[model samples]
Target: MKLSQLGEFGLIKNARDIFKSLNENIVVGIGDDCAAIKLRKGFLLIATTDALVEGIHFKLDYIQPYQLGIKSININLSDIAAMGGIPLHALLSIAVPPNISVNFMDDFFKGVKDGAKRFKVSIIGGNVSSSKNEFSINMAILGEVKKKYMLLRKGAKAGDKIFVTGYLGDSAAGLEILKRSQKSEVRSQKKRKLIKRHLMPIPRLEEGRFLAVKKLATSMTDISDGLASDIRRICEESDVGANIFTKNIPISKELKDFTSSQLKTRGTHPADGSSKLITSLNFALYGGEDYELLFTAKPENVKKLKELWKNVNIPITMIGEITKKGINLVNIDGKAIPLTKEGYNHFKG
Candidate 1:
């Protein structure tokens, strides 16, 4: 059946299928009046709101209303999670066009519900309207974290080791493929890595909480705005400079394997011993929306984090150190580099 016939309910029902991908803490108000969450600790409540717009935040064709629905909420959840907070509640508001079907709205809410469920959070309330000609969503999320665990973008310090979770640059590559869809680029290995990373980014809520619990972070920021921007945030907040090494940055093996095979078969150089794939190391460093964590830790906790990486399989790479002074994204080979905030910033474009 076409989406026009499905109406809102049918769309919502369909989006429920991807709920398994988000947090598991949702209790009440999924299909009911306001999500009823039984916060285990009931600490001081913290909240945040973020918007995802049709043309600005995402394109409708690349991401369905359902996926956009889930993603819009998830990114906000990630913000709180970055602060080491447990998400509790959210209020969603949407603006839609007259031509849009009820099914699109339903699918959108279903995504909203499922995403909230992933964080064990809920939609306590929200508004819906049809006077606009575009799709827009805003979710205000509520959560709790210990006062001590409340991480601020300004808490990092000099002498702390700079670390980032997961790999980088996949999302940028993905965007490239998505835009170049008409050219039929046979899905390069590295390109797929970026695409997949961009499409289905997982918010590191649990891992972030774990970091806070262990008192492992001195300063932290996620790579949503790109490694350079987030690192710049931490450094500026701490009144320090950073020196990230090019050698240590982690690019995904999936990217390497895929790209290598594709290139080798086609007689092209997949990666010529240098690790960067789609964009250069500089691009990955500055390219935004990776959503992985970038944090600083005391020297002692840095050691502990290294050991922990093996157990959880969460790679914590030390790209550099918080220094006394300039955001120096340098090379071990003795080159002083000037860095740019190359990641996703609305004003930059």
Candidate 2:
């Protein structure tokens, strides 16, 4: 049945049934005017809200409703992780077209429930509204961390070393493949992995928490808007400059192989591959939604960080150093090129 037939109140009732609270701290949940939760006394509360809009942020044709639900929650959880906080509760709000089916809503909510369950978070309450054309989700997440463990983007110093967790460019490349897959008939295991990375990004919560609890990262931010833009955010907040080495920037073997294959298909010579590689590297530098952590640490902490990381299972690479002032991308031969582009811009198109 269409949402227009069920109406808003009936829809709310169904959602309330689906999202009954698992967290005992929630005193008043879904049917109430406000959700009441007992905040732990010793920790600081951190709240973040994010919105995903159809057409702009996502395309329904390429994404399943269930995956959309998980993506929404994961993106918000990433915000908490960036701050070294543990997500506790969430409030979900959605505006969907009345023509959408109830089964679609069920699948979407199931995705939300699964995501919350995976992270041990409670969905206390939310609002649902009818949209004329598009579907949109806005999620607000509440998290907490000890005051001492909380991290910020402003703590990086001029002498700090820069680091990133996991691989880069995969999501962006994956997105490229998704856009091209409709026209091309290329299917490979590497292609699937890249697509999965874009659709179901894993937030670096444990890694972020480790950095916070151990006081390892001097400054940090998640790579939501691409490394080029996010690193600039860190630099801007810390009032410092950076020198990122091109050779030092970590690229996954999957991404490298995919790019080489594409170039070969286009009949590009091996010697001309550097130009093509640079284009692929742009995806790593400027493509958004990698969801990995880009962080800075003191040089002295490098040894300890590497040692601890061995146990954590998250691969980290030291990409560069915090410079005295000015952002430069240094080549393998030691030529410093001024970084000219920022990451994905919503309003710049």
Candidate 3:
């Protein structure tokens, strides 16, 4: 059946029923934002796995096989990071097309090995196979968190502030570059930044560990499906609402610079004048694969989180707040406006 027919929640709800507890350690299973398991030595084993296919997740044209292998592994680690867990080990599984050379497979594993070294994670065991249409990599992460420290997706409370790490939309920009492969023509700076953004997503592994150790996040999820979808997941899980100021969103200057150049050079203006630039920003908001961390925190903890991780990659912005009802995006003038989700979906192009 079509995913749209079942819908997101409906599909998960139906498929989740088949997820019988595999581990004796599983205290809480597939339903919550993060899986929970009873661990032996005061740890909760938090596991997350994500797979990237050539066409669906990425294209060979934009990213190198080495980086692709690294990302396929790092992104799962990003999930572990979102839960504020210490990533210990990972399992790699790959299916390469017959056209892919054996040397290419070696390079891919080398990239995976390099990624494991960077994250201080070990490679256990994994499967490799040949595919028909595309090469795919799936990595399963096994991490441990203090029982009390595992961040959840459903713990946001009303009045809590919403925050995300780093700037958004570069990944979308990268995809744009991939789409418009005519590198000879003048490309905007923001589009260049976007290309880089998509190519190398910095997993917030250290920051996630810091968040767990510091006890800063109330509920959390990574921005895999852009800010809009992931934030909506948190709200749905918590049965709470959120409010983020459009002005509060942190736009990377590089992104701004590149996109501005594109608009002027191409003579493409936004529907409402300059706000047409919102497309790239919306890509940042809804496009998947940024892999940054998004979490909610009480207003009281804002000062502490700021002081705690000041030296981190980018500033954390309180884009909106957790509301009691539904997700609401307000304009700079305080008018209520609906944010059309422009993020990626697996089945939907």
How many collisions per candidate? 17, 0, 14
Best by lDDT, which number? Answer: 2
lDDT, candidate 3, residue 112? 72
lDDT string, candidate 1, 100-164, tens digits: 76666667767777777777765655665554557777888888998888787787677888888
- List residue ranges in candidate 2 displaced over 4 A: 183-186, 264-278
lDDT of 1 at 2: 44
TM-score computed on alpha carbons, candidate 3 = 0.81
Better model by lDDT, 1 or 2? 2
Stretches of candidate 1 off by over 4 Å are 1-42, 183-193, 254-278
Candidate 2 root-mean-square deviation in Å? 3.7
Reference-based TM-score, model 2: 0.94
Where does the lowest 10-residue lDDT sum fall in candidate 3? 266-275
lDDT-best of 2 and 3: 2
Return whichever of 1 and 3 wins on lDDT: 3
CA lDDT for candidate 3: 0.72
Task: Please give, for residues 208-239, the per-residue lDDT of candidate 2 as tens digits.
Answer: 99999999999999999888889999999999
Candidate 2 backbone collisions, by pair = none
> lDDT at 135 for candidate 3?
76
